[model samples]
Target: EGVAAFVASQGTLSYQLEHFVDSHDLLGRSVCSMGSSGSKYISSHEDSDSAQTHEGVTVVDAGTWVSEPALWVEWTHTGRLESVGETRIFVIDAERMFKALLHPGLRAVATQYAGEFHKRVVTAKPPLASYPSDIEVPHADFCGIVCCMAHPWRVQIGMHAFRKLAAAGGFGTGIAAHMKSRLKHEILTGRSVLVVSG
Candidate 1:
């Protein structure tokens, strides 16, 4: 969260806007370009000159895109097989898969319902509607992972499973956990990597 502080004065903002705006007549993103074209800059901080910026936006990647997260698995198979054939299944780590899916955020919520509630807060991943007073606020991203992975095995969370996982204070069903654990340790079939470059 960021705080907003407005300091208003007669003709101050308007006067600044005159220099700040272009033909669009709006204080726009062009100002960052202006700096590249020798525009003036002011800084309140003593060492602001050394700070680096790019294209007017800073270099920060959001953990989760401000959108719902989903994982989709698809494969193309060929009939040709070796004489001594084998079936290989590749499973990605739940934590790593979730980490990559949630590359931008660790505890990012999916926003089914966010904001303060009358009795408690309602921030959870992938749209859960409630929380206990003692447990940590859940993440919507994890819920998305569980839901997507749960689809393949048809492991619906029943009442007993729900109660058991809930009793342990985890946001997962037993089937979901079993599915995720299988995914986490399932062997991979990616081509060997020789060069690692960003």
Candidate 2:
């Protein structure tokens, strides 16, 4: 279940969940276009081991597309939704989540790894910074209170959700681990700050 918001004709922001459908219609589809072989995009099914079908994928632009091989995770949608003012929050099914994250554009490594081997090997490509350090944040003015906020309550709730999922084992652990690492880096470096508004 994923959350999405759209403005209704009446100019009201409405939110809804992309409700999960327990279908394997897209189970074995090849997400990458280079060739018709490699890891199949994840499905709604719980057994990721059973869903994997190994083949070969020809990496077109290996230098830029290849990323370090890692384990693909499968998670169940909790089917829960939360509303915080104008924000509606929900968890997406593993299939959609993995598809978005493991899209070829993000992880371009030509070779795919399976099982425990994924953990030991790292990509030879040098890491590139996503953005330049000296970039400026554009300022915008709103005549009224445009209450976009980074509420402490929301942060705590997100942290708690990650922790809960992580405790459930499997892919959640990876998600939590990555989230923690990124959060710590941001806090220590002060590279970005969440603005709180009353």
Candidate 3:
């Protein structure tokens, strides 16, 4: 649900814009040239005799042409701006912020509603076919049901079934005990098990 929400918020257009800007700035940094050219020639003049006077001169190509100085400068500046933008995005961490904003409300709603619904269902439903007695009954049914309830469509279906069972007052203590045992086993083993009785 969180992932879905995040993706929905950052639709394809936003993703494309982010990608384009990132790629463009990366290319600019790599392609733009920015450095001073070194002197190409060294010159020395000297006089001889007892004491000699010497002078050295370094010659540079002052008129050397840069293919696109203005363009390079622009690209460099753009790259810097892009980098700052990216850093700001991370520094702000909007994804984390969004999650923080949504988590409390969503979690509270799911916990209160879903837990009560599940409990009422268990209290009112007939026990699922007895374990081992109903050879056709799947051992993973409870776990599967839990997983299904997590899905949006199945959540509604599950809630409906819970309400019906609760209204009927069909669930028994034995079934609840069986479910508790199965849940305990799952917690211990780090694996899910179905409690058909519950």
The runs of at least 3 residues in candidate 2 whose Cα sits more than 4 Å from the true structure, single-residue gaps closed, are 1-149, 170-179, 183-198
In candidate 3, where is summed lDDT lowest over 10 consecutive residues? Answer: 8-17
Candidate 3 residue-wise lDDT, 1-198, digit = tens:
011111111101111011111112312211111113222111232111111222432222222111111211111111111121111111222234334656664554344434433332223212542211000112223344455444442344344444455456645554675775554455345354222232
| Clash count per candidate | 8, 5, 3
Cand. 1 TM to true fold: 0.14
Candidate number with the higher TM-score (1 or 3): 3
- Predictions in order: lDDT: 0.22, 0.24, 0.27
Residue-by-residue lDDT tens digits, candidate 2, 116-182: 2222221111132111000100111111111121233234333444455446572443466667678
Off by over 4 Å in 3: 1-179, 193-198
Q: Please give, for residues 33-117, the per-residue lDDT of candidate 1 as tens digits.
A: 1111112112221111222234332211211111111111111110111111222222233234434545332223212112111
lDDT of 3 at 99: 44
For every candidate in turn, the CA RMSD to the true structure comes to 23.0, 21.4, 30.3
Q: What is the lDDT of residue 34 in candidate 2?
A: 12
When 1 and 2 are scored with TM-score, the better candidate is 2
- Predicted structure with the largest TM-score when compared to the true one: 2
Give all TM-scores, in the order shown.
0.14, 0.17, 0.16
